[model samples]
Target: MTFQAETPKDDSARQVGSILAVDCGSVFSRAILVERVEGTYRLVACGEALTQAATGEEVLAGVRRAIQRVAEVTGRALLSERGFPIVPERADGSGVDALVATLSAPPPLRVWLVGLVEEQSLASGMRACQAPYATVCDVLSLVDPAVLDDVGGLTARLQRLRPDVVFLVGGTEEGAEGPIRRGVEALSLAALALSEEARPVLLYGGNSRLRQTVEEIAGPAYRVLAVENVRPSAERERLVPAQNALEGLYLEKASHWDPSLDLLRSWSEHPLQTTARALGHTVRYLGLQAGMDVLAVDLGACTTTVAAQRGQAFTLRSLPGLGMGAWGSGGPKPSPERLALWLPEAIAPEEVLEVAATLGAHPCTMGQVGRELLVEQALARECIARALERAGLRPGLPWDLVVGCGGFLGHLPRPSQAALILLDALQPVGVTVLAVDATFLGPALGAVASVEPLAAAQVLEQDAFLKLGTAVCLEGRGREGDLALRVRVRYENGDTLGVEVRAGTLEVIPLALGERAELELRPGRGFNLGPAHRGRTTRVYADGGVLGVVVDARGRPLSLPAEPGARRQKVQEWHWALGA
Candidate 1:
C-alpha cells in the first residue's frame, strides 16, 4: 500500500467533499464523517467498534465494516449519495472522500531513554518522553557507573528491543557537558551493535559536548537529530522538542509495525499519531490565536494525558501510572493513603479501593453508589491537580480557560452530569472559565492545523469548543457551609438578575454563546475575591459554556461534627444549593 499526503490550501470556501476521521484509541476505534455544506463542514455520520478484537488484517476489515455501517445508517453510500461526490475508488475499490486514522495502541511507543542521572536528569527525561505518546522502553542512566562499565551488556539490552527511537536527554545548563558526553558514549556503543537496517534513530536533546560525537557515531548506522534539552534547568522543563521528536519517530518508524498502518496508508493524508497530537494542536492553536493559556486533559482507558499551552510553549504529560484502564497491572496502583488525603472520612477505605480498582479494570463504568461517585471525583481532582503541578501550572494560575475532553467528560448522557463530572475532576479554583470538547475532534483539527492553521482555527471556533462560562470559587479550602457564592448580573441593556449559591455547588446559569453578560460576585462575610483579592465588586464577561460556575465547598476540609447524619445532611445541603 502507498501513503498519500494532502496539503489542503487556505481556502475557507473550498468545496472539500465528505471527509472521515478514524481515531483508533486503546479501548475503541471511532469514525466521524463531515460534509462541507453551505461553506461550512458539518458532521453527518459516525461509528465505533471495540478495538481489541482486531489487529493486522482484522483491523483493516473492521475499518471497512465500520465505514460501510456508518454510510448505510446515514443514508449516504460510502461512494455516492445526492449532493456529495463518490469518494474516489482506490485500486482496491473501498469508498471514502478522504480517510484519516490515528492510533493510541498499547505497548505504547517504546523509547530508549538516555539521560544524565537516573534520579534527576533521567527522571526529567522520562517525564519529557511521557508527555507525548511514548513508553520508556529502557533508560540508559549515564550517571550509573555500572552502565559505563558494562557498555557491552547495555548495548545488548538496547539492541534486543530494537526500540523505535532513542531519546537522548541530559544536563542542566550549568553543568551539561559531562553527562551529555557520557550519554553519547553509551549511545555510540549501542549503535555499533545493531545492524544498519535495524539501527534505531537517535534524537538528542542533551548537552552540547556530544553533538558532533553523536552525529559521527550514528551517521553510518542510524538517523540522528539534535534538539533542545528537555531539562535545560532545574527550575524549568522544556518538553516540546521531545514530544515533536516522538511524533516524528512514530510517523517514520512505529507506524510500520501497527496492524492498522496499511489501512491508514491508503488515505490521502499523512497518518496522525493518534488523539495526542490533535490535543497538542488544539492547546497550541488556542493559546496562540486566542491569546490565552489553555489546559486540556483526555482521560482514556490505558492512560491519561494532561496538555497545557502558555504563550507559544506547550507541555503534555502522559500519566501511565494512573489511568481509568486495566493495562497498569504491574505499576504502582493508587493507594488508600493517597486517596485519604482528598476523600472525606465517611467514605470507607474499602469503598475507595473498590472504586479505584473498578475504574482501573473497567475503565468505562459509571459509579453506582453516591459515595463512590464522590470518591471517584476526588481521585480525578487529585490526578488533574498533580498533572498541572508537573507542568508548573498551579490550579489558581489566572488560567483563562480549562477544557475537558475524551468520552467520559464529553459524551455523558446529560449536560449537567457532564458539568458535574468536570467540576469534581478539576476542582478548579479562582476565576477560570471552563468548557468540554463537544466533538472529540481536537486531535483531527490539530493535525489539520499543522498544514492549514487558519482553517483549523475557524473549524475549532465554529464547531469544536463549547464555552462553560466563568467559575466562581475561593482560592483556599472552606468548611461545609461557611462560605456562600452569590452572582448578580447587571446587563448593559439594564437587565438585573441574581443567583445565590453555596460552596461545593456547580450552578448552570442560562446564557448563550457570543452573547455577553456582566457578572458581579458577592463573597460571604469572611471571604474576598479581588486585589489582596480585596475588592467587593468584580465584573466578568460571561460567555455561555460547559461547566458554568463551580463553587468548591471543599476549599477546606468540608468538616462536619461526627454525628451520623450530620455529614450526610451537609452534603445534601451543598448538593441542593448547587441544584444537583
Candidate 2:
C-alpha cells in the first residue's frame, strides 16, 4: 500500500520548517503537522483515519490515509509518487524535514517471569516488563506454593504458556547464587522439551557472578540476554537495564507480528518507539521542566497507562486487560453494576453490558451525545480508577498537574465533561492543574523529542494541551448539605467572588482561560482541603483553563448514593453543576 499525497514538482528553494509525526493506534491512525509559525513551533494541521488492521488491510494503509488527509487539509504535498515521505522540503513546499512515528497497534509482548523472591527481585522484574508494550502473562517464583510443592511444574507451565520471553530475575549482586543456579538449571530442562524454534528467549537478570553460569546452562538452544541485577541489593532496585532490554524485545516482536512496521520504521531518523514509552518520556519531561510532581493517564483501545512522577521518583503502570476498548476480549471487563456507578442517567445494567460487548468486538464504534456516550464515559472512569490503583499513588500527596491523554478524554463534546470525568476518576487532592491533550499529540511530541527537543517542547507548551483549570479537592466527608469549604476567589483584575460549597456537590467559579485567581479556602470543621491545609484557611494562586476554577467539595474518596434513583439524580446534578 503506497500513499501518494500529490504530484511532484521541481522547485528547490523552500526552507525546512515543518515536522510530521504519525501515531498508529489499535483503533485509529493519527497524523499531525507542526510548522514554525513566526519563529515558534505551532500545530499546523492534524488528520486521523480508522486503523485498517481490523479489516484485513495493510497496516500502513491507515497511515497512508491519515497522511493524505493532512496533505488535503494543509494544501501541501507530503509524499512523493513512490509513496514515500519526501525528505528535505523542496522549493514548492512539498516535503517535511523530519518524519517520526509512534505505534501501539501491535499486541503487547508476552513475558513469563521467573525469580527467586516474589516481592523483591520478581517485583522489580515485573515493573521492568511493563516499561514497554509487554505484559507479564504468568509469574513463577520459588516462593510460590505450587512451585514449592512441584518444582517440575515450572517446565510444564513454561511449555503450556509458550510465552515469547522468559524473564528470569533473582538474587542481589554478591548475594547467594545457588538458588539462581537452580533456576537456570530448571530453565535448561524446559528448553529440552521444546524445539529450537519454539523455545522462548531467556533474559537473565540476576546476581552478576552467575552470568556465565546462566549462559552455560541455557547453552546454544536458548537465547540468553544477561542484564544487570534488578535487585542489586535488598535496599536498592535498578530496573532501567532490564526495562531497556524489554523495550528492544517488544519492538523486535512487534515487527515480526507485522512486517508492515519495517516500512514505517524506515521513515524515522531515530528508532520507532512504543506509544506508551513515548508518552512516559513526555510525562517525565513535563515533570522535570516544571520541577513539580506530575501524573498522566492515557486510556487506549487495548491498554490503560498511568505515569506518575513525584520529584525524582517516577512510576508507570500499564495494565493490558483494563482498557475501555477490546474489553472482554482478553482484558478484564468491568461488571455492569460497576459501570452503573458513574452513569448520570438510569441506564439498565443489561443495556450497559450489551454496549460494552459491542464496543469490545467493534472498538471503532463511537457514541453520540446520549446514553451510549454516558456508558462509554462511565467505563472510562472505571478504567482510570483501576489504573491509578495499580499505579499505587499515595493518597493526599498533591499532584501538581494531572494530564488526560487519548481520544476518550481529549475528544469530548465539552471541556467541562472532560473535567468532570477526570475529577471523578482521579479525585486529586488540593491545588492541582488539570489538562488534556486536546490534539492527541502526546506520543508524537515524545517521539519527536529524541530528534527535535525544541519542537517537542515548544509545541507542547503552546498548542498541544488544553488547560482545564485548577482543581481544589477537599479531603474530608460531611453531611450531604453541610458546609464543606468557604471559598473566596480574588481575580488578578482586583475582582473578588465568594462562594460557599456544601458537601456532596461540585461547584465551578467563573474564570476564563488565561485568567488568574487567588483562592482563599477556609474549610469547615473536620473538613480539610488536603494534608497541607487541614481545617485551616490557606491561599493558593491558580491559573485558568476552559472550565475556569473548580471547587470539588464532594469529599475525598467520593461516594455515590446506594439507591438507584438517588445515585442517578446525584450524578446528573454533578454533571449539571460542571456545565457538562
Candidate 3:
C-alpha cells in the first residue's frame, strides 16, 4: 500500500510526516510508526518484544522483530531483505523520512553531589540532579558526617564512589560564598589526588559571582563548568543549566560506551537521546502549551523517573535500584519490610526481599502470581513515593494532572488498579486529572517531540494519551470516619449521582467512556480539598476513564492501621470500594 501525509505550512512548524521510533528499554524494545495523516500526526502502528540485552546482544534481534511486525501488519516495505531499515522513502514508498531512537539500556549514570548544606543547597542539588539515567552515589556537604573539611576525607570518598561526574552546587546567587568556595576547594583537591585517567568530570552550579574564584581552585589540572545556580533563592530553583550539562555529558560518554548504539546511529537519520531526557523536554513543552503544572513518572524495569514542570521551572529525579531490573554497581537493595508493609496478610519478610532481589536481576512476566503482584505494587508505591519526596516541591503549588507510565502501569489488568497505584502513591490533592501513556509509547513520542514539535502536539491531541478520569482528593485532616467530602456528578445523559465519603477512606464513581460530566465538590468543616478551596465547594469538568471520579478522603498523611488484620481489612475495603 502507498501512503501520503501532510507538512505544516510554517517552515519551523513543518516536520517529516513518516517517522519511526525505537525505544530500547531495559526489558522491552518497542517500535512505533507515526505519520501525518490529512492535517495531523497519528500513531498508526506499534510492536514490542523482549530486549534481552541484559543477557547478551539480543536487543538488536528484538528491535528487528518489533519493526518487522509493524511493517508486516501495515504491508509496508520498510526493511530490506537483510533486515536494516530503508533510508529516506523512495518514490515507491519503501522507506520512512526519518528514524530516531531513545534508550534506557545503560546502568544508572554515576553522579556525586557536593553542596554547602545537607538540607538546603544539597537538597536542591539533589532535585536538580535526579533523572532516570542518573545515580547519585553520594552527597558531600559541609555538614555531612563524611566530610570533615579535610582533603584526605573528601578524596577518599570521591575515590570510593568512582563517579563519572561531580556536581558542585551551593550558595544562593550572591549569597554566602564561603561554604561553596570550601566545596570547590575540596572537589579540586580530590581531582588532583586521583590519577588523570580516573579523575571524574566536574561542574559548578552555584554562585555566579565567584566563578573565577572557583576556577582558580580547579587550577589547570581539572576542567570546571559553571552553570546556573540550582538554588538561585529560597523561593525558586533554576535547574535547566545543570540538567542540560548532565545530559550533554551523558550523551557524549554513551557514544563511546555502547557499541550497539553506533549501529543505531548509522541506521537512523538523527542522534539518539536518553529516554528520560527526551521525556523531560516533552513534559516542559506540554506544561507550557497548556499553561498548567504537570507531573509524570516512568517506572522502568531498571530505573524510576519523575518529571514535573511548573511554568518555566522543571524538576526531574531519576532514582536507581527502585525498579524491577538491574540498577548498576552499588545500587540499593530494597528493605524487606518496605515490601511486606503492603501485603494483605502477614508474610515472611524474607519472601518479599527474595522476590525483590530476584526481580532486580530478572523482570517478572506479565502473568504474575498473587504474591508477585503484591510485591510489584508495593515496590511501585514505595518507589514513586521516594522519588516525589526527593523533589521537594512547594506544598501549596497546584498540580493540574498526574500521569503514570511504564509497562506495569500501562498493562494493568484493570484500569482501576493503575488509578489506585497513582492515587496511593501521588495522593494528588483536589481538582487533578489522571491518565496513562496508553500503550507505553511515552519514550517514542518523547523522542519524536524533539524534532517534530507540531507532529508531537498533534499526536498528543489525538490518542497518544489515555485519560483515566479525574480525582478530587482531600488534603486536610479531620477526625477519622467523620463526614469528609460530598461529591455530585452530572452526566451528559441527564443522569446524576451523589456520594458522601468519610474521612480516611476512598470512593470511586464510574463515568462511562464517551460521556461528558461536571462535578461539584463540597468539603466538610476543618477539611480541605486543596490549598486554595478549604471548606468551600469547588467545581471542575470531569474526564472519563474506565474508573471515573475518585473521591479520596484518605487525608493528607494517608495512614493505615498498625495491626496487620486491621490494615489488611482496610486495604481490602479500599480496593473493593474502587473496584480495583
lDDT tens string, model 2, 1-580? Answer: 0112122254363533788989888888889898888867789999988879556786887888899899999899998887888877788899888888888888887899989888898888887886657788898776544554454676678778888889999888878887778777767786777778888889988898899989998877589998998999988988889988887887887777788889999987878888888888888888887787888899877888888778888787767777778566666766888888888787887888777887798777768699988998888888888888877864455788989988777777888888888888888888899999877777788877775676778888778689999999988799999998999999988999899999989988888998888899998865787766664899889999888888888887788899988999999999999988
- Which candidate do you rate higher for lDDT, 2 or 3? 2
lDDT of 1 by residue, 348-377 (tens): 778777777777766656664477666666
Candidate 2: where is the Cα deviation over 4 Å?
Answer: 1-16, 142-156, 394-396
Best model number under lDDT: 2
TM-score of each: 0.78, 0.92, 0.84
Residue-level lDDT for 503 in candidate 2: 90
Query: How displaced is residue 434 in candidate 1, in Å?
Result: 2.5
The best candidate by TM-score is: 2
lDDT digits (tens) for residues 1-580 of candidate 3: 0011234467575458688888877688888888878856889898888876455664566777778878987898888898799868778877788888887766666789887867778888887676447768887767553564678977888778988888888888769877677667666776788888678778888878888898888865466778888888877888767877887677666655666666776787677788887677667767877787899888878778878887777777776666655422234667666655566766677777766666666673543547767777777777777767766653334578778988878876777777888888877777778888856666677788666766666777676668887777788788878999888888888888888889878887888655668888888866786765664888778877767777888787677778878887887788788776
lDDT, candidate 3, equals 0.75
> What's the lDDT for residue 170 in model 3?
83
Q: How much lDDT does candidate 1 score?
A: 0.62
